[model samples]
Target chain A: MSYMISKATSVNKALDEAVPLCEPVLKIREAMRYTLLSGGKRVRPMLCLAACELVGGQDSTAMPAACAVEMIHASSLIQDDLPCMDDDSFRRGKPTNHKVFGEDIAVLTADALIALAVKKLVTSTYFGVSPERVLRAVLEMAKAVGTEGLVAGQAADLAGEPMSLEEDKAGLEHLEFIHIHKTAALLEAAAVIGAIIGGGSDEEIERLRRYARCIGLVFQVVDDVLDVTKSSEELGKTAGKDLIAGKLTNPRVMGVEKRGNIFKGLIQTRWFR
Target chain B: MSYMISKATSVNKALDEAVPLCEPVLKIREAMRYTLLSGGKRVRPMLCLAACELVGGQDSTAMPAACAVEMIHASSLIQDDLPCMDDDSFRRGKPTNHKVFGEDIAVLTADALIALAVKKLVTSTYFGVSPERVLRAVLEMAKAVGTEGLVAGQAADLAGEPMSLEEDKAGLEHLEFIHIHKTAALLEAAAVIGAIIGGGSDEEIERLRRYARCIGLVFQVVDDVLDVTKSSEELGKTAGKDLIAGKLTNPRVMGVEKRGNIFKGLIQTRWFR
Candidate 1:
């Protein structure tokens, strides 16, 4: 936990310095900074740093990639909270971006952040890593956020809203698809990119990718359990909102205990290794 | 016009092949393709290809970057026509993206396209250009689309809506700022990137950049003039729509004839040189 905290602190500082509120577009910049600087667990960056260190790399070597992952994550959250999407009014205990900046600016804010994330990765001259590796990481980040990854997961999840979970064989498979693409794909990319940028061998990168996949699944399952068991206050977000939204979740498809056990088992296997 | 047409055809083909409708996110992919494949003049791509050729580079060398600029342009148009933005119902004689797909999908479609644009640029192996040049082009594209460029222009444009244009020095400066960043920045990027990818000297690149800046501004001024002078049928889009929406434009700042002369003078100087 302390390791994660230290890494998060470094990431937050870098992110702050990276995206300042400059002139001409101060409103949109503020909107972007408001959401990006909002406190989260910084799990993705932590995972990236951990993967880099596991492969004998320093934290500075992975900082840009780490920051890029968090920026992408922030942009995703901003879009998810728009009135056209999840329609949430609060995120991380603050009013959502659209709620504060209006929908037009919120949309632009997300777009800017996405562009900035790519810019940061490609333009960062401090990489102790090679340019080819940096380019590969940029490509990986792009793929993770596009139609083949997060957008695909989101589209499928929306389409599956009408599906009946009870007595449906395809429900479990569909749920897995959503979780894997929506959650695991980015996490997997984060770890793999960190490893690549940190100069890890192809085999080591492959191993980290697999490990992150397991961790990503466990992260989603735990989220499902928390959504069912925790209150909105406890979770720092609207708990059980997924259920209310008629979205398919692991705990809803299977019992909470079973889902919890699966989460625990996956975590143990990945972490112990 | 024939030269532009040939370049447009090649660009359209590359763009079509770049973003195919695959599984899992077919809906969003369709949404992206719908807007992208719906034809435009492909002005930015033509500029990129032309600049590349001017610098002794082949068409294939600049194809990916050309496609990328168009993708970014398409994404911007999609977002600009959203309900919370310009709220336009039609673009290029077709219904806007959100009018066909829901607003949620429309937003995601734009987001996906932006990510894919970056991906396409970085992953293009046919680049006769060096990796450093490709990376520089990617970085340029990023800055062109982010807060300091398009978003800044957009936000300022929106905010300046309530400001009275008469007898205001700031209004003219603001209008120029908006047009320079919003329109000229991407166009400049397209040409500069093409030149870089084509292995142009620093002097050549700078000259192309200046020429592109002039051309981009002229393009917008011509658009403003056409909005007032041409009918909807002639323009292939809703004419006088900017006036109705209370958006600031070049003709709105100056008279139509004055703006038209400025546009003509810009084109003559840049092209005839």
Candidate 2:
């Protein structure tokens, strides 16, 4: 826990410096910084750094990639909360990005952050990571953000559309597809990219990818359960709003009690074993 | 003209292959293709390929970079035409992206195209472009897309805000600032990245960068002038809409005749010489 706190602190500091309020586009930068610096658990970046260190890399080597994932995560959050998407009013206990900055600026803010993330990862060659590894990591980041990843998941979720299934079935399979692409994909990329940057063997990188995948799905399942169990204030976001919007969730599909059982079962099988 | 036609043909083919209508994200891909395939002049990609060849690199070596630039340009156009932005009803003789695929899908389409551009550039290491050059190219692309480039230009243009000027002056200087960032920056990046991929020396790359910058600004000035002079049918887009929206443009800042003179002077000094 102490290790996590220290890493989170470093990440927060790094992010703050990444985009300072400078001349000639201060508004866009402000919107970006506001969304990025808003408090979160820093889970994805921590996952990146941990994977890097577990593979014998220095913390400094993966810091940029760590920050990149966080920026991408922040970008996704802003996009998800837009009026055209989830239409959420609050996030992390504050007004959503579009609510604070107008919709146009909010959109541009998200786009800029994604570009910044790519820039940071690719330019980290100064940090002693090889260009080959940096290229691979960037490719992974792009995959996680694009059609095969978050966009597909969000689109499927919004339209409740079937994806690559033989039948247009709406079941656990569909739910898993949405969660895997939308939530787990970036987390998987985070760990995989860290391991790659650390010069881990292919086998090691694959192991970390699987580990992150399990953790990501578990995180989403728990989030779905909490949406029903917690208050809006408790969650620091609009709780039960997913249900109001008729969005699918673990609790909605299988009662909250069963979802808890599934969470524990996942831990027992994927982690303990 | 034949060289231009051949290069644009190759770019179009490469782009079609880059984003096939694959399963599990058909809708997103449709939106992306709908915007991307709509005919544009393909000027940026041509500049990229031409720069690479001039630097002694094969056209095949820079084709991916060329496609990537086009994708980035298409993404910006989609965002620019959104209702919250310019609110244009038509682009490239068809309904704008948001008009055809709803605002939500249009937004996601733009985001996906950006990601796809990065992915295409990095993964093109298979083209035998060295990792060092690819990394450099990716960094350049990011800079052109982020706050210092397209985003900054769009934000300033939308808000009519002065950028880095002493007295918030709004004239040719402000217009120049907007055009340089919004248009010239990406074109400069395209040429620079092409030169890098072609293994050009620093001097060669810098020279091409300046050359592309001049061309980009000229392109925008001519576009602004045409917006006033051409009919909607002639332009294949909404004509005279800039004046209708009271958007600041080269013709609006200086009369159309002076803008034309500037264009001729630019060609004479930058190209013909």
Question: What residue pairs are clashing in model 1?
Answer: none
**Candidate 1, residues A147-234: lDDT per residue as tens digits?**
8678877777777664564645577778878888789889998899889877899999998988888878878888888888998888
lDDT of each residue in B58-113, candidate 2, tens digit only = 99999999999999999999999999899999988999999989999999999999
How is the predicted docking of candidate 2 categorized under the CAPRI scheme?
A: high
TM-score for each of the candidates: 0.94, 0.95
TM-score quality measure for candidate 2: 0.95
Could you say which candidate leads in DockQ?
2
**Model 1 misplaced stretches (Cα beyond 4 Å):** A264-273, B264-273
Q: Scored by Cα lDDT, where does model 2 land?
A: 0.88
lDDT of 2 at B221: 88
Q: lDDT per residue, candidate 1, B1-273, as tens digits?
A: 887888888998999998886655778988989999998989899899999999998999889989999999999999988889888888888999999999989988998888889888875555556667878888889888998678877787777673465744676677778888889889999999889888889899999999898887877888888899999888777889888777777777766767656666666764436
lDDT of 2 by residue, A65-159 (tens): 99999999999999999999999999999999999999999999999999999988875688888888889999999999999888988987887
What overall lDDT goes with each candidate model? Answer: 0.83, 0.88
